[model samples]
Target: MGLLFLTIFLTDFFGYTDALLRFDRVRRKVWMFVGTRSPIELDWDRLTPVSQGITPANSNVNTFRSVLLVDLDAEGDVKFDGKYPRIASIGQTSLNEQQAISQYEYVRQFMELGPTHLPSCETYLEHRTVFRDIVRFFGFLDLARNIDWRRPGETGGGLLVLASILCMLLGWAFLPFDLATYIAYRCNRVPKWPAKIEAYAKDGGEMTTPVGAASGRMRIVLKEVPFILLWVGCAFAVYAWVASWFIK
Candidate 1:
């Protein structure tokens, strides 16, 4: 069952559907599609002098080091072209960036939005990202493995030590790290994309509720609460384990 769950989780983690940025030459419209639904549509005229740029990935993959996009405006303002401003990559990730870059070149070659310039974002990536969570989990497991189980007099006592280490790491290190990085990301991305839109743009937000924003927030809570609760359980385990040891 554990293996089955890991298998399923891995599938979902790595799985991607068809995401396309399509241009309707006849209609002069750009449609951004995820699977069958067109999430965003922009008239070709809405974007101009398409600009190509790479910014540190604030919300997406981390390995790429940067998220590349095509900007329609000279300033590459997200507020101005809030529509489908970003072009789709041929594949995904840095390799995708190469393909996306080529695609950008291809689009700019014929469509002629305007002058082309390479732009970079001036902010840090988000902290509560899936990638970060995965990293954190594996990091803790690694830490757990390296723990000196014999140091605290017993293997069980070492569990308490492990828990304290993790709790301290979460409370002291990760908390501040998340805050600082998020602040930087927000400050840099405000002009590019508003806080409100940014909040709703991810899996964190849900569209099913009458209050779409509220639903999205709930989704984040649901995804996040488990991690929190897991840590809390570990903390309790640590306390109980230590207390039992002392009692004896």
Candidate 2:
């Protein structure tokens, strides 16, 4: 029934097609609604992609969390502080690498062309990837299914529980980073944050600066001694609490 309603009336937004857009030509902005949450409005004048790249996915490597990082000017008018620019990331748990790239391309193209961009797919792959990313969200059920009481065997239950916990941790930890990136970008508060994340993925990060200094300042603020200490402290505290639940 929900799907039916969306198809009949909200298909454009769900399909991520031309219909999702609400343009005010005089204002020179565009809107996108993904159905489950409030729509996102974009002001083309203040948009720019600071960087775009992805890390390879691998199960054995804890650091192999795939990501695409982008910087935006949040408020879309002017920066209050020269010291602060904004950053947001997209990751594999939320989307495969291909989908993140598509997002960049779409936003980049949309800003470049104004509302006339009209949400297009250059190829079938592009369409398939978008729909696939949207559907992959439902994949979270797999974690819950693993926790079913009907299941037997320590290995199965424990592994699934651990996977679920890690998933939650990933989101919790990403929250600050993601919030820092988009909170100031839009005109109104977004209902749900962007699921995109640039996973830490590899040993040393690959970051490019399109308009600002070479991340030295951001590193000091986001990754330097003080923040890193707080992050590590919180992570250990959470791990200890969760471990206590199962150590017995």
Would you list the C-alpha lDDT of every candidate in the order shown? 0.44, 0.39
Q: What range of 10 consecutive residues in model 2 has the weakest lDDT sum?
A: 126-135
lDDT of 2 by residue, 1-248 (tens): 98786664443232332234443344554444445655455554544543343345754433222232223445454332233322233323323445655655665554456435646332231111221122111243233333445545545556655644554555345434334323222212223323421121121245323332232112122212332344345555776788999997
Top lDDT hit: 1
Q: Which regions in candidate 1 have their CA more than 4 angstroms from the true location?
A: 1-17, 34-38, 48-76, 80-91, 95-100, 109-248
Task: Please provide, for model 1 over 1-248, each residue's C-alpha lDDT reduced to its tens digit, 9 standing for 90 to 100.
Answer: 99997786454444332234545444565555543333465666665433244446584443342233433546755532244345433334453445545655556544444212423223322212332332243344334434454575545445645765666445434444444433433333111333433443443334232222221111122333444556546655666676999899
Clashing pairs in 1: 49-113, 49-114, 205-216, 206-216
* TM-score of every prediction relative to native: 0.27, 0.24
Clashing pairs in 2: 63-201, 65-201, 74-184, 74-185, 89-196, 90-196, 90-197, 91-197
For every candidate, C-alpha RMSD to the true structure in Å = 17.3, 20.3
The RMSD (Cα, Å) of candidate 2 is 20.3
